[model samples]
Target chain A: MREVILKTTQLSKRYGNFTALDNADMTVYRGDIYGLIGRNGAGKTTVMKIVTGLTEQSSGEYEIFGKTGKAAENEKRKIGCLIENPAFFGNLTAYQNLRYYCYQKGITDLKQIEEALKLVQLSDVGNKKFRKFSLGMKQRLGIAFAVMDNPDLIILDEPINGLDPIGISELRDTFRRLNAERGITIVISSHILSELYAVATRFLIIDNGKVLKEVTKQELDLECSRCIVLKTNDTKRAATLIENKLNISDYKVIDSGEIRIYDESAKPDEIGRTLIQNDVTVSGIFESGVSLEDYFKQLVGEAQS
Target chain B: MINIIRSDFYRIFRGIAVYIAIGIMLLAIGVSIYMIQPGYIGNASVGDINNENFKTSNYDEVMSEYTLDELRAMSLSDYRQVMLKVTGYELDRDILGTNINLYYVFIFAAALAVTVDFSGSSIKNTLTSAISRRKYFLSKLIFVNLMCLIFLFANTYIMYFANIIFNTKQFSSDISEITKITVMQIPPVLALAAVLTGIAFITRKTAVFNTVAIPLIMVFQLILNIVAAALSVQEEYLHYELQLMLAKLANNPTESYMINAYLICGGIIVLFYTAGWLSFRKAEIK
Candidate 1:
């Protein structure tokens, strides 16, 4: 029964005839990693920006730390946000950029600059300019700047964008560390559903400027129950045999040697026998649980169609 | 507020603006020195008295006739009269181009300052850092004003020092006139900067807006000057006779005291900040 740090009621934003965010409702509880899942233009960034006061909503209301007002700016002091692309001084070094933000927040802890850089694992880039950093490094730097203040609520939009697997894993671990070690509530918006599931404790799926569902980790686990997985060397042949012989039509042959059947009852042994009898190479067979990617496609497809 | 100012100052001083401002000041001093040199004008001057094509023939006649001693004597005895006549004298029609321009450096510096925010994306980051839009805009305005002041002072002092070091020209001692002229120019510089800052706040792209704005502003200022001159109100109330007077009120003082300049600049800053705050507070920041 953690307290709610942020709550929005029917918050809407419009740009002329285009509604960017439509009567969206969300709540970020204390010590929670709330995942905001959406496509490129699904209004995730708009929601984060509105809550952070970087943008004004056309209608509806939001409360931050129990404070409700259009000009309730003081509550923002407890929140840190990195919206959209990482905005920073390009000519400044990572350290200098962090220091600039620290100064702006009136945080006199000079050691925070070093700590921020260290947290991002960019301590070696002491004097290198930000423009020279890779896209992954820039994304990490954006996160570092956001979290350096040690604010109670941290909101990140597209945090894993342009990040490699290693960098993505590193940031995921950092998010967990921040939440568990520091008791900071995190609200992250990202298109990477798998990574979001890896670090987030709750999910807020949005589409076409509206929230489709707000599910917790327990709900997501419940929804992501057993999914049929069939691995075979002859993926195309296996997929064709599964659709034609097994009559499980909706299936996807991913990568070089993997076929996934959405139906949980479609046993891999039956698929393996069908593949073997059909002259397809039966390399591996198993029943796997549903991954976040599968769950996301299911959720998004259900809404989209 | 102090934090915003400090951060803004660092952001500004670390960019290309430092080089540009220094470059402008150095170039101004270099040009002023060249212009004030004893024989530098000879390159453009002709010895022929009746040569109508010669741009500085009249000034050349005055200079060629007077020896160093005579010039020194005139400078010591009737410096004000000599300077007034020399400064007021119209150049030969051939040497005088179609237009005489002033405040190119000021416009350049102001435009650079206004565009820095867009080119760097620091404005967005700054506003999101627990600082209100109003305070952020104020800090930026203060940073711009400080940049302008530095350039203005640098240009003035560089010109003075360069003339003393390289050229043998006697620096004028007309403090009241110089002060009036300097004071009169400050308001418009501030206003021009404010206007450009507003445009940058609205457009949020330096390369595009500045490319279009620089020439457009030049033309607008030219037209405004002509219209103001034609209206004849400048001569009556506004001190269009000087640079700063164009943006100042009719009841403004002519002295070099910075209070009036500060007031005018402060008002313009408030207007710009208000506009910028409104625009930014509503902007999507996409």
Candidate 2:
């Protein structure tokens, strides 16, 4: 088994009468580009903040590299993060800002600063003050800071928010390269599912401060596989019929009285006919595949209901 | 912790505010030196030859009643010194020697040093680094105090240079005495800077710090004066108060009084620094 880089057990956070996170549990393993998926106010940033030590969890325990409480400071040193907007001194140049952190981290070699700048494609604009940089440049510089320390794990919250398409693509490549070449575990949260789909090795779906599901990329891919979706009065019976009569057991019963048959060889018309013959009231039947976005929405919708 | 301190120093020196503050302080010192003149005349009896305007006042006033002939007979340096004393430069000892504007300069420096982290949201980066919160807060406190000391020394140097350039008759006090008085001023000035730093950390806005700290210092001085007056405290004991200690150090340098000022100012620095650190450690970075 790969080592678990980060784990939180029943983490919770509250603000006065308002509860921001409720019994949230999450896990990230070594060398996994973990994607955190959630809508607005879904406790995504809260989780990242708590992990990065930016915010305190009201009640619960988190372990970084199996170290809990204060001992995690050492573990935290091996982790880097860019939570929310990238914070930097507007008066200092990009190189100066990164150099400041480098000194803080005790990395005396100036070459690392140059390397980080080059990695983020900020070498050319290293002398420009942060206040003068555009939003995209700021975001890229933030990435440079995160990766500069060569941390074992990098947690980014909406890291690509203001990037243009080209910038986003380049950052995606950067993430993939870091993960693959350095064997670094990455925890990233973004609303752009398709972009996330391109890089994430695993997905954690959250809603209302609760973890709805955690699935690996292979499992999610299988979940999103081409399949025939059938809405019937009784999905359990429909599933049984499809398994018994059609000799197909690869199917899942989703919420809203729907069954998705993953048997690629089985046609939707044949499945529909078989359901009807088995006295199953087939209200709707269609051939479709779930995108990550659709799957996230469905999971959240089910949790709400 | 050392690395964090180094980083803070880098950020501080690279920024223009600190340099600007130092420049303003130097300019203020230059202006004060150019404006001040020594008290030249000793206690001389002018009762026999004074005009009617001299009748209402004493010996100090008798010198002010000099006739045109007497004024013309006086040397240029003596004339300038008398004029300076008459214009209340005697009470302006603090302004001329101790760099009176340093109090405000410290206020500005402390606020700029601390609040820039907040306004830029750069504290998040620092806190998230390998350094602990305690170390970060300690570094800031040390940085503010160190900057205050540097400004104090700079002001003192300028004052010495000004004295050498303008006071051709030589200063009444020796270099060692001047150094002792200058050193005594540090504790109170540092204590004040620490308090302002605490306020800046709590408010995290330069404007807010200025608005709150200025009035608060004035009110504190007022309250101290009222209490001193009510208690019928001796003029010497009043030097033990916060702002008065600095002023007293400038006007009246005494070993016993310096000891008391040190004790009080040292206590205040400790109290304010502890409070500031606690608040900073507990504060939620948004």
Candidate 3:
């Protein structure tokens, strides 16, 4: 089994008359680019804050790196985070600010700061004061700070909120590269499902302070993949006919009455004729697919409604 | 915690606030070296100046005609003779005053160094990654007090030596007495540091800290004076005030009074430190 990097069980947070997070549960395994998809004020940042120790959970518990409570706190040194905003001393340069954190985190060498800035495409402006930075620059610096420590796990909240398209694409590649090359596990949150779908290996969708769904990349791909779905009870005969007559092998048999063909070469009319000729009742047949955005809205909209 | 402190200092030195604070202090020291005269002291000892003596017939005339600078420019014996004729007494415990005013500098510096983190939201970066809330609070508390003490001693000794070099031996008191008064001011100064740090955590805003810090001691003394006066007790309650304690400490306070002040300040330090930490322990960083 893969190592569990972060696991939250029934974690909740409340502020006075409002509930920010309610009995939310999530788990991220090592080397997984876990994407937390939620709309604004949907408890995505709340979960990140609680796990990163920016705020305490009102109830329930969470474990990081297989440890809970105080031990979990000690384990936090191996994690990096950028929650809510990129807060740094305005007067200090980006390099100076990261160097300060390097000291705080007990990092002896400073070259890592340069490499982090370079990864975020911020090396040219590393000497510029933070207050003088543009919003996109600030976001890049925040990302740099989160990755500079070479942490085991990274938790980022709306990290691409202000980046332009090119910056976003570059950072996406950076995250993917870090996860692939360095084996750094990351849990990134965003309301933009399309952007997240491009990078995340696993997903957790939350809305209205509750977790709505969790799905792996393969499951999401299968759900979202465009295909022709056929319903038939005679699974044995239908499979033989489809292979021999239709020459469509890119398919998955979901159950006794459903078989989905992923290859575009399998025409609906040909499959229907072939199945009917073989005395296999084709009860239902049509194209079926859903975009990631539609699916996220459906989940969040259902919760809101 | 030490790492946090190291980073904090790194940030501080790179900023302009600490240097500006030091500049203001040095300017105040320079101005204080010359502008402060017997007339500015306002101590009860000034009441001892007999108005009828020759060469000081008009008490205001001699002070206005010869500034302390001009008087000190004269030979030592000549300077002492003129001062004895004008005030009818020598320098007393008043000139070697407590460094209570230095506490204000520390407050402003603490506001910049420590409180700015909360106001600017940079605290999120630190607490979210570098350390736990407990260590954050501890490092800040220790940093504020340690920085305060360092500035406090450095300013006091600088002003102490400056006073001796420029004002002549007759005007400057003994080094041992000046050291005693400076040491005696510690409990109160450190107590103020803890209280300011507590206020920073509780309020978590620069404007609020400044609004409270700028007028803190004066307000405390004013309230004490009002209570003492309203109760028809001849201002007895004013003795516990921060400025009042400062004024008293410089004037050779009694041993029992020193002990009582130490105990009270000790209680204040503990109360504020624990209160600041507890208040900060669970604060939701937004």
Best by lDDT: 3
For model 3, the stretches where C-alpha displacement exceeds 4 angstroms are: A228-285, B38-98, B233-236
Looking at model 1, residue A187 earns an lDDT score of: 94
Question: Model 3: per-residue lDDT, tens digit, A2-102?
Answer: 99989999999999979999999999999999999988998999999898888899999999999999889888888888888888889999899899899
lDDT of 1 by residue, A88-118 (tens): 7778899888887777788888888788778
- Encode model 1's per-residue lDDT on B95-213: one tens digit a residue: 11110122444445545555565566656566666677777666666766666666655554454445545533333323344344444456656765676566666666777656655
Worst 10 residues of 3 chain A by lDDT: A295-304
Per-residue CA lDDT of model 2 for B1-286, tens digit only, reads 6787678788878888878888877777555455443221111111111122223335357365888789879875576666555423231244423343576778767776688778777777766665677777777787778878888887776666665566532332455655766776777888888788888877876678778876776677677668878999886565466655565676555678777778888888888877778777767677
Residue A233 in candidate 3, Cα distance off native in Å: 11
TM-score, every prediction: 0.74, 0.85, 0.86
Q: Rate the local accuracy (lDDT) of all candidates.
A: 0.68, 0.77, 0.80
Question: Sorted on TM-score, highest at the top, how do the candidates line up?
Answer: 3, 2, 1
Candidate 2 Cα misplacement greater than 4 A, ranges: A229-259, A268-288, B37-63, B66-100, B226-237, B251-256
Worst 10 residues of 3 chain B by lDDT: B45-54
What lDDT would candidate 3 get against the real structure? 0.80
The per-model DockQ list reads: 0.42, 0.57, 0.65
